[model samples]
Target: MATTASTAAVTSLASVTLEVADLPSARRFYRAFGVDTYVGLRASEAPSTGFRGFTLALTVSRPSIVDGFLGAAVDAGATVLKPAAKSFWGYSGVVQAPDGTIWKIATSEKKDTGPDTREIDEVVLLVGVEDVKATKEFYVGRGLTVAKSFGGKYAEFAAGQSSPVKLALYKRRALAKDLGVPVDGTGSHRVVLGGTAEAFTDPDGFAWQPAA
Candidate 1:
């Protein structure tokens, strides 16, 4: 739990809206990964270009599961950016969803000492912002408690031990460098985050749709 004071207005991550060129294609692709994506906006309204400001991460409980997910993604027509491999933190891999959204599947070996659940244990929506400090403060002010922070470089919020999803903020330039991409991205982000708030746009232009 967060030791710092919190309003606790926001409870959990309900969903994420991705702007894709082909809604049906994107839906099919994500559904293949076990996501029940809600297609709210129309195809004509979606931007021609895809958003690249964020990456969705799926954390599992074991290395074998990570490999399984990577294989499934490949079979689902997802382009593999990185094959499943062992890392200092764990075994992981990266794949680009058909709609251009990057999905990283990983499992921390240190945290994988337990039994294999063979399932996605957690979903992390990692937002890349131009100014990490400002973004961190913005979310913190909105009743979110910071679970861990490292100066302005990165921060993670604790939704709860049982919460299926978690939120994280990262430096845009740093994240771009890590992903081997350019720092600047254009077009409507077409991503919507749902919370307790009615409807608002963050400092970085990410939209938040209030949960019904």
Candidate 2:
């Protein structure tokens, strides 16, 4: 199990690969959001269905920025699951990626008291797992350090000072409720996380592929 003192071996989120039926369309949609996404065309399998048990969160510094991002995503053909609105946490919106992945674009109202950059400053890949504690231990055992943790609720891993993206784990049911989705998500995740120590699938079936 990973302790608080575990060293962080993962540095950055190298890439997030999405398996798409129509690769070109998926590319166009994500590229509009400034994500240099790597698309892998499905050779034989049918397209995935329903939620994939995770959501990629793009965090900015202001409320207006959330509207801009959500608008851009809608313009680029993303399906808006939740419209941009001010919530207790901040302003946020949800969109389903063209490749079937869900994304939550948000900004903290408490933190965005200064000038607004209106630009995405950080990316947090939130993986919904059946057990937050056990999953946190799994990553810790693999040499990732816990930056913050709330017992059985959520846990965040330190992705180094210079890393643009960080990794986080959350309880599946809680995450599903927050996203207004079902707890038992069906079909493929359609997402791949690259730049990890080993290639393994988490309890909820999110794949962490090795860095190329």
Candidate 3:
């Protein structure tokens, strides 16, 4: 079974969507500012929306849109990831920030009520530690409360107010076994947990802790 994170217990995600004109140029600009980009597809619902004039549509439009959407955010200095790119799917590219906000730039492809309903349900945490209790204590110290407990095997932490990220703790070995892969806790891998919060593991051992 796949482990899950509890967003309801954690902070809630603040989200927005924007339409963009260009993908590659926007991506390049962000890169110059030192923001990493993650290439993604245009929403299948785009074509139905009758949107044109751009190869992709960012959830948050780049250039003026981003500046306006982020407002004080840019002034506060947010890290730029990827600028943008044209995806293989014919739609343009988009990127996300450390925040759950998604920046899309491209033409709408198709229209639908929403994407597939089978999206990830929760973010699962694979903790590498000799003692589960100690790790649990570490997060609890981080102001997260225990929402559900699975013996000593796993625990899902409740998010605090305004926190959109959900936290889960699992024995590293157990998680690997469940995924049908060799357990290597020493290295790092991106764990894209499900639910409203978008989570990932970046390079370095540092976890991409998402804000709720």
Estimate, for each residue in 1-212, the C-alpha lDDT of model 1 and write its tens digit. Answer: 22235444565556566666787876677677665443232253644353368878888888877877777778888887777878788888888877677778888873445554447887888889988888887777776789889998999887744445678999877776655556677767656777875566778888777754
State the lDDT of candidate 2 residue by residue for 143-176, as single tens digits. 6789999999999988755445678998878887
> Where does candidate 2 stray beyond 4 Å?
1-13, 37-47, 110-118, 160-163
lDDT of 3 by residue, 1-212 (tens): 11245422213222212222344544444444232232221122222121111111223212333333233324433333333233344333333332222333332332233432222222223343344576566445433578887777877666444333345566656644433334433322222222233453322222333432
| lDDT at 131, model 2 | 91
Winning model by lDDT: 2
Error of 1 at 88 (Å): 1.9
Model 1 lowest lDDT segment of ten: 35-44
lDDT of 2 at 118: 50
By TM-score, the best candidate is 2
Error of 1 at 167 (Å): 1.1
Clashing pairs in 2: none
TM-score of each: 0.82, 0.83, 0.35
Which is superior by lDDT, 2 or 3?
Answer: 2
